[model samples]
Target chain A: MILINGQPENRIPVSDRGLQYGDGLFETLAFRNGELELLEQHIMRLQRGCKRINLSFQHVDSLRAELAMLCAQTAEDSVIKIILTRGSGGRGYKAPLENEAIRIISSHSMPEYPEANQSGVTVRLCEQRLGLNPTLAGLKHLNRLEQVLARSEWDDRTISEGLMLNINENLIEGTMSNLFIVKNQQLLTPALTQAGIAGIMRSKVMEIADSMSIACHEKALTVNDLLDADEVFLTNSIIKLWPVKTLLHNDTNTHWQHGALTQQIQNALKDLAH
Target chain B: MILINGQPENRIPVSDRGLQYGDGLFETLAFRNGELELLEQHIMRLQRGCKRINLSFQHVDSLRAELAMLCAQTAEDSVIKIILTRGSGGRGYKAPLENEAIRIISSHSMPEYPEANQSGVTVRLCEQRLGLNPTLAGLKHLNRLEQVLARSEWDDRTISEGLMLNINENLIEGTMSNLFIVKNQQLLTPALTQAGIAGIMRSKVMEIADSMSIACHEKALTVNDLLDADEVFLTNSIIKLWPVKTLLHNDTNTHWQHGALTQQIQNALKDLAH
Candidate 1:
């Protein structure tokens, strides 16, 4: 069974560009407590990401409604994915000259966070560095081969996640999540102005940091910065916040355990589930 | 009408990781006068690409038949695309512990290359450089937001394409097509061991050059090589060969122009297309 546009259906034109060039945006949000985890934030990111790609924003509200309806069906915790593509035509990169309705695809699946949250994951730095494209950075658009490749780097059950850097060898985010490092009690993440997605979870953490008076800054972070930091952790809507028990800095055999700050942030993020 | 194992279908499951994580491989081929243009070469590249991503090859034969059927449906000349995504369910990047099926999606559309072929195109070198991930570099995997941003750089109809480079400053390929530079008398393209797709059109050009006893070398390319080149051109199956009338070298006032070598390679590539 499928829910396409608030109705049960099974057909979308094969020419939809999302199926073509992945010319679209997607939000993989958590659905719990009978509500979308961050519906508005996902919508805003979808809108912002659409503008970044020059895709028309028509029918977005209807699509959002469709997503809400689909998520409402499960009644239990699930991972809801919302995909909005330029809806098929106008040849390659050109958005259809006429206004094209964005195709909406909302799917639900059992959430996979409880296990990771129970036992902090062993994270490693991936060799595949995210490119510093300030323009396309921060939005979780459809182009995800890099994440797939980075995630494919290891199948070892022990390694939970991988960190990615930009071309300048600056630590960025993970294959799927955003990265945060605490150095001298200051919260820092690699500036998304160059690369990396400004994930909703990362944004939430920044807001929380401000509320608590923690100095949070977005700046360039290198392997050295992360290696020498007081603490390191990763965040995504699904993962919430994960304290890194291990880090594979590109240079040496040096590794560190989850620091006090990682614990603090992880605790704060966990409370949001309640 | 459609064909997947010779049956019409559209759905590939909501949990299909390819749709979820862009975890799949794809090929866009031109079908002219009833022939699956570059059939063997395209399939070989797809096979090599699939292997790199670790997707199963079991359904490849039936998938090939499906493509042939899809292409046959296009009585008139058209562009054909076949996407082979690792079908469904896996937690994060780890491939599902259980065996997985491959989802094959094929679609057809008319070629959109007339304007580009008639009047040569002006291209801007995109600020969004392609990420250099050796693991996913040469494969035409689903993660393609980089190209989307590069292609979105221009809205003017006259500017046909954009040139992309790796973060290390090595010239990669056009947002959609592979690039070729003719300097003095040799043919050159940036090697794709680290970035860019090894386009079937590129392979054909190399064959044509060898047959004509023209030296075609794949090596590292830089802005300096392009700025000093005698002729510059871009190629893909759709736009057979497009000469670079002018190229925007970043934000600089510098531009590349049409040249003799560009014309020769254009004609040479056209000859091989028949």
Candidate 2:
């Protein structure tokens, strides 16, 4: 089902800035057993994105209500996507002074992954590099050609995800998830001060680590650091966590055991989900 | 009037990747006195952009026919915009194997600029900076949040445009146009190898300079380079060329005469338009 500005429609005007210049923000959420997971965190992130882009999105309560309404009708686990655009009709890049935000909420069946993926999945390094823009860092905006190009680098069904690095050669994130590495029993994730998205599931994992007294840090990470790590994992709202069993970099095939910390975090996340 | 894939419609599917991830490219063109200006140049640039992004735009002939049809019905000078998107229905960032391109062609009334703007216009330095990524540079793709943010920095009607620099503080281009500096009777425009859109008019200006035997080079430019220039101007498809009379930067204003070379190029462009 799709709701465009509270209406049952599947079409938007051709002039929408979201379509014209990708002037919008989006959130991918999980709905499990008729409940939206991480609803508040998703809303908080969306709100921050709107503020960063100066898009006036004034439908928070109504959007929440609509999500609840949609979830109640779904019988299976689903993925909900919400798109908020700086509404239509502007001369060019300069936005309309009096603007109303356009909200699109849609739901789709959750992707069915192989059962083995839960244990561990293979990941590859993408050739496409992300551009460094601090102003847009950490915001899940609609301008995502970099991710799309990176994701297009491979079509191997066995490789679950592709990781991307910024132009500076620092490992930043996966095409659809945040990356984390465990080294000497310490958790480290790339700081998104220059690029990459600050995913909701990534934040949740960090919080869970803090509660368990695990040392977690956000800093610049390199391929060398990732290759030397004790364990590695990827996270997103849909796929909560996927342990990296093997990494394909250039012609290399480094392997890991999916270690103790990854298992602990996975179990903690599952417990919270229930 | 508007046309979506040869149909006279103003709405597109909400699932369009153009809106979802900005997986698209667009071109802004000018139609004057029932004739399209630089039609081939615009189409060539769009084709190049489509190739770079791997979007199979297989409707060049039909697109030309539609633009000619749209221009035939217009009785006044107009601006035409064409947007080609990588159709719909993709899972996450990975594109669908079999895809069709979505084309949107629309016509708008020409913007009314002050007559004095032809003589010279004021420009300001934008605080927003563009990110550097060679993979996406020079292609007029749909990821334009950086330009949108830069244009939003000022609302002064008198300021004709804003100049943007990349993260490295290298002067790249104007918010809505390409920039060129004249020094020692030579022409210099910032190289778009690392960032900035390679505007169609920028290419035309370079060609015009070459025909006139004026030395022209594309190189990294700084604010000091701009201020030290003998003359400065901006170019785009809509506003053919506007000599920079005043440059507002960091609480100081630098002034310039329209310069003889600028007038000579303007006359040459006018002759070609006729």
Candidate 3:
């Protein structure tokens, strides 16, 4: 079901900034048993995006309530998406002085993924590079053409995700999820100060690591850093966590045994969601 | 009138990848006397964008024919806009294997611009720096949050436009148009190899300069270069050209007495549109 600003509709004005200029932010969270997971973090990120882009987000509290009402109607597992655009604007690029942001809230049944995805998944390195933009580095703004292009690079059912790196050859993230690797008993993820979205699941994993007294680090990781790691995994609000069993890069392959740390983090993440 | 895939409608599916991920390209051209100005150039740029993003543009001829028909319906002055999106896809970043691009064509009355704009206009330097992405550079794709943000930086009725620079501190272009400056009888515009759109009007300006025996150069320009120029101007498909009479940067100001070269080029461009 799709609700465009609390009204059931499947159409948005053609002049919407979301369509005109990709001027918007979006959140995709998992909803199960009448509860939305990590909704607070998502809302916080959305508000942060609005602040960064100079858009007003004063109605966030009321928006949360509307989302809750929508989730209350669903009893099974589902994925909920929220798209907040700068609304319709004039033909020029200048934003309207008096603006009403458009909020598109929708829900869909979760896709059935193979159990193999949980055990482990294979990933390929993408040729497309993430542009360096510190201003838009972490927020989940709607200018996601880079991600869409990276994800389009591979379609093998056996290859679950594509790993993307910034133009400087530093590891950034997966096309759809954040990445973390285990090296010398320390968890390391690429710093998103230049590009890539800082996923909510990534933050939760770090939080869980902190509570469990495990070491987690966010640094400028390189391809060699990833290849030398003992274990690798991906995270997103929807997928939760997926241990990467093999990574194919530069026509060569590297394999991992899926270390104990990945399992521990996975179990912790699952526990927190419930 | 607004037409989505040949049907009159002002709404598009909310699930459209254009609105969701900005996986699309758009063109805005002026229509007067039953003909689209620079229609061929617009189509070429759109086709080039499709190729750069791995999209198919085999239907270009048909799309052009439809646009011509739409333009014919308007005997008076109007503005025509064509939007081509990668159609709706599943909830992931991965594009659908079999793609069906969506085309939205629309027309509106010409906006009334002050007669002073034709003579010359003032501009301000925007604090929002455009992200450097060579992969997506020069293509008029839909991921325009940077432009939107830059344009939002100012709203003074006196300032006709805002100048934007790339991450490297090099003057890229105006928020809504390509930029050019006349220094020592030579026209210089920023090289779009790193960032900025290769606007159709920019190409026409260069063409006009060539036929008029004027030297036009595309280089990596700096603020110092702009400040030292004898004349400055901006170009886009819609506005054609607007001479920059004054530029405000770093609390200081640089003024130019709209040079004769600007008028010559502007007159040449106007003649070509006929």
Candidate 4:
């Protein structure tokens, strides 16, 4: 069931700027064990996304309560999506004077995670490169044509995910996840100065590194660095963290076995969520 | 009034991927004398946009009939916006199953062409830059956060448009329109190899240039080229073409009188539309 203004309704106006200009933001999370996992982080990111797009970040509590009620009704492991748009903006780029209310939607089923999570999942380099825009960087806004294009590069379900590089050939992140590498025990991630949605799992992973006395840095990395890394893993709120077993570049493959620290970080997220 | 599936309905399903992952395409056209200006070109672009996004262009009859009716119902001059979305995919990036009917939304309103088309509009340089993604470039897809951010940079209605540069500091296009420049009787527009939308009016002007014996070339242009241009103008279907009288670049001013060729092209669009 869909929740509109804290009530169950399946209809959103076609004139929604979200559907028009992609003038909106969204949050997808793992609603498991009767709780909205990482609820605070999701709301924070949603607020920042709204601010980035010049939407008013208001009445978040009303939406948050609705999310709890929706999750309360679910029966099994599920993926819950929360979309907050500028509602129905006028027929132009200029935002409407009166914004539409936030839309809160919940679903009750999620696809099974790859069995190779322990053995490391396979990944490919995407042909579609992302553009650098620091202003919109780090916010999980709804203008996701780049990710959709990147994800559609191939239909191979075998490939766990795809790595996207920016126009400058700098490795950004996976289609829907952040990329992290371990080199000589120094955890390194690509900087978000250019593009890529800085994932919430990424933020938590960085924090875990800080607390666990692990060396972590958010710096720009190229395809070469990732090729030479001792270990690589992808992170997102939905998946938490999954190791990469192989890299598929230009249809060729390179091996990356699941490393020891991969499980440690997954446990780290589970600890925080529970 | 709104048209969804040839009937009046304000509500679209919440699961529409156009609102989910921006899995959609759109076209905006000018209406004059009850005819859609460059209607075929608009449809061709929409078709191309759907192809790039892997959306099977469907329901052409209903969308076309509704658009025609809306345009006909309007006064002598109007604006038409047609939206085609991937029709309610479940909350994920995956393309929905085949046989999902296309959702077409058409809206109409009076054109916003300013009274002082000859006086030229003041243009400002937007701080936000366009991201380069050739896969989605030139197609008027729904992923438009950059344009929304750039348009948000200014609230002054007097500023006719905002100029957007790419991350590499190359001038791409305006927030909502394609850009054109004239230097030494030579017309140059940015080649949409990486970023920016290939607008219908911009394409029409190129045709008018070819017919009018004006030298028009699409190539990579930088901010320096714009600063040194003999004339500058922004093109979109509703506005046709608007010359720039003054440019506010990083708070500095550069003025150029409206050139004869710019006016000639604008006049051509007006004559062709009416």
Question: Least accurate stretch of 10 residues (summed lDDT) in model 1 chain B?
Answer: B97-106
Model 4, residue A245: distance off in Å is 2.0
Candidate 1 residue-wise lDDT, B62-154, digit = tens: 777787777667678777777777766666556664444464646566656566454477777887787666666788887776776677667
TM-score of each: 0.85, 0.98, 0.97, 0.93
Model 4 segments beyond 4 Å from truth? A97-101, A114-116, A250-252, B97-103, B250-252
Q: Rank the candidates by TM-score, best first.
A: 2, 3, 4, 1
Residue B227's lDDT in candidate 3: 92
Stretch of 10 with least lDDT, candidate 2 chain B = B265-274
Residue pairs whose backbone atoms clash in candidate 2:
none
Lowest lDDT 10-residue stretch of candidate 3 chain A: A265-274
lDDT of 2 by residue, A1-274 (tens): 9998778889999989999899999999999866788889999998899889998877789898888777777889999999999878777999887676788999998999988887899999999999999999999999999998998888899999999999999999999999999999889999999999999999999999999999999999999999999999999999999999999987889999879999999998884342
Which order, best to worst by lDDT? 2, 3, 4, 1
Better of 1 and 2 by TM-score: 2
- Candidate 3 is graded, for docking, as high
Give me the overall lDDT of model 4. 0.81
Model 1 residue A164 lDDT score:
83
- Weakest 10 consecutive residues of candidate 4 chain B by summed lDDT: B96-105
**Candidate 3 whole-model C-alpha lDDT, 0 to 1:** 0.88
What DockQ do the predictions score, one after another?
A: 0.40, 0.91, 0.91, 0.72
RMSD of each: 3.9, 1.2, 1.6, 2.3
Stretches of model 3 off by over 4 angstroms after superposition: none
